[model samples]
Target: MSSNSPFPSLLDGTLSLPVTPLIRGALEHSKKITSPTTVNHCIRSAYFAILLSQKLARKDAEPLDAELIVYSVIMHDLGWAVDKSLLSKDKRFEVDSANMARTYLQSTKESGVWDKHRVQLAWDAIALHATPSFSQHKEPEVMLASMGILADFQGHFIANQLITVDEFKAIVGAFPRLGFKDQFIGIMCGLCAYKPETTYDNFVGEWGCEFGLDGKGTGKEEYAKNRLASTFPRTLLPTLIALAEYENEAPAE
Candidate 1:
C-alpha cells in the first residue's frame, strides 16, 4: 500500500480494511454517544465480522461488503447509551439502535452513495444482530453482523482455523474487552430497569429476571420461577390459543 492510501491493512498487512469518511465519522459519533466499553465492543465486533465475512466469502464464492459490515457493527449498540434521555421508553434496544443507524445512513440517501437498499440492509443487520437463529437465515450482511457480535462474546469457533489465534489476539490488543461481560450486563439491566416491557420478548428479559430487574440492587432469582415464561414447557400453544378464536371465525381460504 502507498503512503497516501487511506485504507488500513490489518493482521500484518494480510487484510485490507475499508475506511471512508462516513465510516470514520460513524466511529467518532459512536465514541461520542456511548460508553468506552460499548465503543470498543462495537469496534471488536466489526473486525470479527470482517474476518468472518472474508472466510464466508471464500466458502460461498460471494464477496461480502466490508464497509457496510463496519457501518452496521459500529452503530449496533446505540440503544445502550448511558444517557437515558437518548433512548425511548417503550422500544426494544435493538429497535432503538436500528432506528438510529437508519436515520444516520439515510442522510446520504439523496447522494446515491447510501441508497435505500443499503440503508435497509444496515438497519436489518443492526436490528437482527442479537437474534442469531433468525439473523443467520437473513442476507449475508445481516448474518455477518450477527456472527461477528457472537464471535466477540463467544470466541468464534473458527478462531484458530479460518481466523488465526494470533489475529484474534491482535484484535483484542487493539480493542480490549474492557470487562465486557459485567459492563454489558449492567447496560442491559439498566434497560430492563427502565423499560421491562420492551425486553419482555427478547433474550434480555431472562437476564433481567435472573439478575436485578427492579434496578434497585435486588436480584429476582425467583421472579421467573412461577411465571408462565418458565413454568410453561409448551411453546406456541398460548399464541395459537389466543389466535384460535379468530381462525375459527374466519372464512376458509
Candidate 2:
C-alpha cells in the first residue's frame, strides 16, 4: 500500500491519506457491524477532521498522523452498533467504544507500529469526542476528531466557518447523510434502554430527555434528583465558634 494517497480536495488543497492495513481493517470492521448511515457518517467525519486540521494549520507542526485520525474517527461510534454485546452496562457508550478500539488496535499483527502512547491518544480521542471542553484543548488527533463529529451533526453552523460550500458538498456527496439523525437518536435511546445509568450527565442524557424511554423517566429529571440528593444544606453548618476553631487549625494555602 502507498504511504500516502490523495483524498478529495478541500480548502484549495488535496488531503493526503496515510494508507495502512490497520486503517483498512478499521473501516471494514465498522462497515460490517454498523449501519450504512453510520459507516457513511464515520467516513465523513474523517474527512471533516482532515479539513479542520488543515484549517488550523496543524499539518505544519509535525505532519498530522492521518492513519491515527482515520482510526480514531472511524471507530468512535462502534458502541452504537445494534449488537448490545459490544456495549457495557457499567460505563458510558464512549468508554465502551474507546476500549473496543484500543483492543482492536493492539490486536493487529503489526501492532508494534502503534506504541502505548499512540493507542492512548486514539482512546482519548474516541472517548472525548462528544466533549468540546476536553477535546478542544487536547492534542491535534483528539481535537480534530471532536471537531469533525460536531461539524457533521451541526453542519448548518460549522460548515460556513471552516470550509467552503463546494467542499461541504463534496464531503456529503461522498457520504450521504441518509437519515442519520433519526437513526442516531434511536441508537442512543436503545443504549439508554439497556443501560440508563450511562446517560446521566452526558449528551445521551439530552436524548433521554427528548425521547422518553420505556421504564426510565427523562434523564434530566433523574440527573436533577441525584444532584439535589447529593448536596449538603448550608443551614446545617456549625456555628461561628466551631468555624473559627477549625479555621485556626487549618494549614495555610
Candidate 3:
C-alpha cells in the first residue's frame, strides 16, 4: 500500500471513497497560493465529482466502473498541485495533470497489472476530461473523459442529496468564470444522447465517437429542460459544499 494516502478500496463490487494523497497534496499546495474560498471550492468539486460518478454509474448499470471513476475524479483537479499559474483555463493544467498521472502510474507499476493501452487511456482521459469542447472524436478515453467532466459540472447543483435551485443559479454564475461553458454544455448534450433514458453503456459508447448524442425527445428545448430537471441537481452538490466551506471560513471582526 502506498503511504502517501489511502487508495480507494473495492468491496462487494462497489468502491469506498479513499483519501487521495495526490488530491490531498494538491489541496495543501493550493491553499498556499489560492484563496481559502477557492481551495474549498476545489475540494468540494473533487468530492462531488466522485459522488456523481458513482450515481451515474449505478444509474447506467455499470457499478463496476466506480473505482476508476473515483480515481479520475480525485486527480482531475490535481494539476493545481504543480503550479498556481495552471489554475486558470490554460491548457497547461491538462498537460500537467496528464504528466503527473503518468509519473504516478509509472512509479506504482507493482500495484496492479498495467497494459500500455490502459495506461494511455487513463492518461488521455485525465488530460482531456476538463476540456469537453475540444474532444470531437469518440474513443475509450473520451468516454471516461465525458464521465469525469459530467461529474465535475453536475456536482454544482446537489447538496446533501437535495438539489437546490439557488445553488444551481450560483453554479451557473460560476460556469463562465471557469471558462468552461462549452464543455459543460457539451456534457449536457452527451448525457441526453440516444434518448432521455439513455443508459451508462450509451454514455460510454458515445464518448469518443461524436460531439453530441442521439438527441432524443421533442427537441433541444425539451431535452435541455429534462436534463436540467433530473441530473444537474446531483451535479451541483459539490459546489454547494464548497460554498458552505467558504462561509465557514469567512473572516470575523
lDDT of 2 by residue, 1-253 (tens): 2424323444445754455677778888888778889988988888888877878883349777778888899999988876787678889888988999998887777445777789899999999999999999998888899898888887646845776667778888867999998888777766666787677557775675666553235454664454344334423344554578777576878
- Candidates in order have lDDT scores of 0.78, 0.77, 0.46
lDDT of 2: 0.77
Prediction-by-prediction clash tally = 0, 0, 15
Q: How many collisions between residues are there in candidate 1?
A: 0
Task: After superposing candidate 1 on the true structure, give the runs of residues whose Cα lies further than 4 Å from its correct spot.
Answer: 1-8, 59-62, 108-112, 156-162, 214-253
Which candidate order results from sorting by TM-score in descending order?
1, 2, 3
Could you estimate the TM-score for every candidate?
A: 0.82, 0.80, 0.40
**lDDT minimum window of 10 residues, candidate 2:** 227-236
Error of 2 at 8 (Å): 6.4
| C-alpha RMSD for every candidate | 4.0, 5.1, 21.0
- Model 1: per-residue lDDT, tens digit, 174-231? 7889999888778777776787767767787777776776534465654444233533
lDDT of 1: 0.78
Put the candidates in lDDT order, highest first.
1, 2, 3
lDDT tens string, model 3, 1-253?
2444433322232433445444454445455543444344444443344434454444445334334434444455455442444433423445556766666666753325657876676676667775565442534334544443553456444335432454334333433234344443443354444334432223332331333353232255554444444454556786787788767675977
